[model samples]
Target chain A: MQIQSISLSDSLILTLLTLVIYQSAAWAQQKSKFIWLNPLLVTIIVLIPFLLLSKIPYANYRLSTHFLNALLEPAIVALGYPLYLQLQHIKRNWKLLVAILVLGVILVVTLSFSLTMLLIHQKEIAIALSLKSVTTPVGIIITEQLQGDSSITPFAIIIAGFAGGLLGPSWLRFLKIRSDIAAGLSIGAASHVIGSMIISKDNPYQGAYSSVALIICAVLTAFIMPLLMPILSVFFA
Target chain B: MKDIIYTVLTITLCLVLGKLINFSVSGLPASLYGMIIYCLLLQLGLVKPIKVHKTNQWAIKHMGVCFIPAAVGVINHFELIQNHGLTIIGIIFFTTFALLTFVAVLAEKYLANKSESSPSTSNC
Candidate 1:
């Protein structure tokens, strides 16, 4: 028992060291080809292999990082400051912002799920995929409400964010979509927190609008998505 | 001191309202409830803005750490990704492009009409 406890302690310390090392490396190499990936991306890449190699159960790693997750609430509250700064612009365009964001949310969620179901033919998986574009917390809630299989939402949100960050701006450029507000808000809204973070780095105004739009749409979708699920389920068939 | 106190109070109220709404609505998520209430309170001036201090700025600066738990979550479901990776990636790509296109067009039309009608703030 003593030896096992010592080994666990050693592994735990090593995991923390690994996390810190990779995180700093990712940050330092921010200008390199590694720029395409963020710290979380780096951590995940390192972690998955470590977990698989050591055969450490994920629940253990999650237990170690649970404190970090608690930070999301305060982080979201901090977003209020930026939103406060941009309140004037948001107010001026409130109607258009609402319409566009809601339409974008509905269209993106609906179409993505439909396509997945047609392609994958798995009802539970499709339900999980539908909430992917929303923020992770809200996606988890929506997936639970819909009784989806438990594992899909988080992965879905991550992929959704990565996709949005990589393709969103290029798509806009391709189509000559020049309105920063619209481009940012739509990508952020569709991708949620991941996309919001990407926008924050590239353009503050787009980041601000997108962050607000994403949060608003996420809340709106949570309340509304469940209502449509039963009806929408028919289409999946 | 005053700013910290006020910020704490506001967040406490926000969380309390969130929990209350969660209890009240069996169907809705608590975070959404808290966020919507927070937005409404701010909009209505019911929750007056507290001045941001250095500590607040620091907290905001490192807010990305909050997602570590969620990021760590990806580790739990390795098998799913190994199997459905391509489909998931495809969905993210197509949905993002399609939605971005739609929003950009709508925004352009909206901005154009607003500029033409208002006759002021044309620089935007």
Candidate 2:
């Protein structure tokens, strides 16, 4: 019979390694030449060097960390409380919220496919790219609907989230935009939950609205994408 | 201390209820359903409402800690991006512009209506 051992020693080793690598990347980030490459990117840089030297393969690393990522769904659930606090704001601004949701969905689908076909000629890639603005789950759904390759959706979603989160605040500042509602919604709409979390830190109120708007946008984007993909297919083809 | 615990308990209950509803209603987003349910609970007195004070302060202060895991995932894809640099850049550019514009216009209009309806507060 084959069995697996879940030992304290193994857990301790993993903890120590995660800490060491995490801290090293934090340190390197302080000195990295490129300003846009943040600590997340630093972790990736440190990981690449270690990934080559270590005997542990990518699958093993994923197995060790899968539990952590699994926590994300529940963490998403936890966001409900904060969102609840802003329920009053939502009710007060229902019309605006609805407008934003509808418009945001149309814009995301239209721009995503249009830009893809205009720049790149690949229809599958264009359809796959249609989901780049959405959160992963809905993005994957849209990707599947368009008959696009599923493997690339996660990468596209992650990059989209990272890009949105990273540039969101700066763009607001650059444009002299100073509305918490706008900042939070844009961040959440573009980046998903992570961007909303970042917005919550700075401004809780918009975080609440944006949190709602983010999910609404995701659902709407998913529902509309399947219909829109075929329309774009003609142009890209 | 009591409030923090209360908030935690409320949040946990909301998650469970949300997950159940999400399972039943596959079309609606789970988190949205949970948020709505939690809001109803708060409104109806089943869940005690939290006063956004000290405990919330802590949550807001330490939110960056949560981003660590997601950031790690981003690292693995650096090479794939390296080859498709232009496409990635182009997509990011257009999406960011589009998202920002859509948000700014909608929010400004919302805020304008809000201010006209009631006394304007610069609080936000």
Candidate 3:
């Protein structure tokens, strides 16, 4: 048991060490278009494989990195600062934000699930896939309620956020979609918090909007997903 | 040191307020409640944004890294990913981009039209 605890602490050190090194590398290489080298992605890539190859079960890894995970809550809660910074924008454009969120949630959930059902023909999997764009905690709850596999959720949310963060800005730029509000809303809807964080790096204004959209989309999905599941099951179940 | 302590205490207070609200309405996520409470405190001048500014900025920028543990927890579903990874990737990819495109265009158009209609209404 003592040896086990030591290894666990070692893993914690390894996780932090990896995070700091990767973050510093990303900082050093900041001018490159190295999206995959994002600190979060790098940490996951380096540490997960290391854990697996090193025979450190994810349980131990998670426990070791619990401090980092715990920080997620406070980090998220602190988002209100930026959201508050854009208070005037939110106040004036709330109607537009709400409309985008409502429409985005409905269409994204319906369109994605329909496409997934057509391709995979698995109702549970399709439902979970539909909730992929929302934040993780809310996604887990909705997945549990809808009887979808929670395991599929982390994969879905992360990949969606990564893809959205990757594609969202380029598409907006290519399409000449210059509205910060629009850019932020889309990123938040498609990518959740991670996408917002990425966009925030370049555009704090849009990042501010993204945080608002992230919250709105999450709340809307939590309420709407369960209702849609029964209807979706009719065709796909 | 002072900034860290104040920010932590303020966030804790906001979280405690979230807990209080969640007690009455159990279904709501506490993080959202905490955010709303903090936003209100800022809006009402109950808390100075500068007091929490430095720490909050760090938290927001590094928020993605904080989610890594949860994301990497996907390892538990290795077989699922191995079997259906492509499908999952494709769905998240196409659907997210499609939604992003739709919102981006629609929102830009809406904001452009609104500004043209009444520039006075928009503060920024």
Candidate 4:
């Protein structure tokens, strides 16, 4: 029997190919700026076909991009910078910020969890869906800890992000909701980073509010899910 | 170049701190621990915000692109998707919209009333 061997350089090449595909797909959609047509969706759309046509295994592809995979953790650590920059605003409206953020986290997590659980009927997946509104790194960690399918967590996150990023602004207009802090906080709670970028481009206040929302929401969800799991297991039992 | 190295070293130090904390606690995620440590270092004035500004902007700008490969894991779970695809996507979409509406309306109302009750002191 012969075993196939691959080298670090080979993995590096594969990683570059994956990165290029991601970048190109994102660039192609940069003109449209449609929320649903986001770069994440585009990357998956384009990458899958290319993998099939090229006869490359998904595991092999993931291993090739192991470098980028490790980079994500540090990237998450870097979130501290944004939060630091925005800390002043948060301090200014500490009361309002705390009130809105705590409320937003509870509403988003509970609503997403119950809705997904009721609709899907899969316990693990319901758990995964609850983490949909968080940033990818946090979402992935929560999903894995809850024993959900980690593979689907990113796709779930993208879907939620597009939902809030695309439809949220329109919905705000339709509802006559005009406060920047409110709108920004809502989008961040529902979508996280992508939605923050969308809101930030038009209004910096909204973006700032949204960015803080991500921090609070992520931190709250992190602790909430772990504690909730044990309680939930007893109930499900 | 200074900014790049400073940011890289800062991140490395914070992430290492986070990893050590995680190793001891075994419950909290390391990145989050790193994030908190990063924030503390900044707040304590040990690391100047200006030092890492450029690298932070660059990383944040390209952050979305980095996560694309992670999503590709979905390709391996086609069977799972086929089983629960529509309901799952539907739930996520509907619930997300509901959440957005709820938060926006509530926050708007709160902020509006606050502004009406008092003249603004700070722009923020």
Clashing pairs in 3: none
Q: Which stretches in model 2 have alpha-carbon errors above 4 Å?
A: A1-12, A19-39, A113-188, A191-237, B1-12, B28-36, B51-79, B106-113, B116-124
- Candidate 2 per-residue lDDT, tens place, B15-91, comes to 67767886986644455455466657767767655542345445533332233334344434556567666785678
**Per-prediction interface RMSD?**
5.4, 5.8, 5.1, 4.4
Model 3, A1-237: lDDT tens per residue? 122554666766867765785587568557675655656556667777877898877776667777776675566567677657655455666687678778888899998889988987777778788988887656755675677766577668878988888678988899998777778778888898678767877877777667667766876787677677678778865
Give a tens-digit lDDT track for model 4, residues A1-237.
222365788788877876787677667767776545666677788888887798777777777777887787888788887767666455656687667667666666666666666666667777778788888878876687668866778888888887788778999899999877788878988888778877777887777677877766887788777876676555444
Error of 1 at A183 (Å): 2.8
Q: DockQ, per-model, please?
A: 0.35, 0.28, 0.44, 0.48
Whole-model lDDT, model 2: 0.59
Q: Which is the winner by DockQ between candidate 2 and candidate 4?
A: 4
**What's the C-alpha lDDT at position A37 in model 4?**
61
- Fnat, model 4, is 0.61
Ranking by lDDT: 4, 3, 1, 2
Better of 3 and 4 by TM-score: 4
lDDT winner between candidates 1 and 2: 1
Clash pairs, candidate 4, are: none
Name the weakest run of 10 consecutive residues (lDDT summed) in model 4 chain B.
B115-124
Displacement of residue A144 (Cα, Å) in model 4 is 2.8
